[model samples]
Target: MANSNPNTEALALGRGKRPKLDNETVCMRMSSEIRENLEQIAEQYGCVYGGKPWLAGLLRMIGSGELLVVPAPPAFNVKSAVKDRLKRKHSS
Candidate 1:
């Protein structure tokens, strides 16, 4: 006999959906650059949670400490490189 519940039928048919999660509203202002970066990470990782959008999953990873932040090394100075090249040219 077929189950009356649509969810059960879906499960039986191998098309079951993930259970929905209750999400709380978190409001904070972030710069457009930051938002874009997070969106990019989400897209890259295919992040999603409880049928939610990629952003939510990414945020969850960050909030749960699953994602560790590493400090980036200082950027190389192009001006210094140019000066070094000039010194080498002059010293040669």
Candidate 2:
């Protein structure tokens, strides 16, 4: 039976892998944005950076494909930073 709820179909998008290309796999316009974001993130992780990217690491996340081009989570240290600055100023 088909899914009755639209939400089910939306959530199930790309949940399964398509059959692997038998002859040769051809990638289309995958946008340079993907690579740029991936490289910046990989550099932050101290993963493969600068030199040629390691193939093994790429294989591990092939399931995510180019969608891994997400921006890094913002860091929050405001409270700690303020406390440390106050301490230094008072101590001086």
Tens-digit lDDT string for candidate 2 (1-92): 97677676644676565656554444445445445444544555455735745333453455457426454446957457556755775599
lDDT of 1 by residue, 1-92 (tens): 86567656556665756666797977878876556566666766778555544777788887889887665557977457656755775599
Model 2 segments more than 4 A misplaced: 1-29, 49-92
Error of model 2, residue 81, in angstroms = 25
Residue 87, model 2: Cα distance from true site in angstroms: 36
RMSD of 1: 11.4
How many clashing residue pairs are found in candidate 1? Answer: 0
- Winning model by TM-score: 1
RMSD of each: 11.4, 16.9
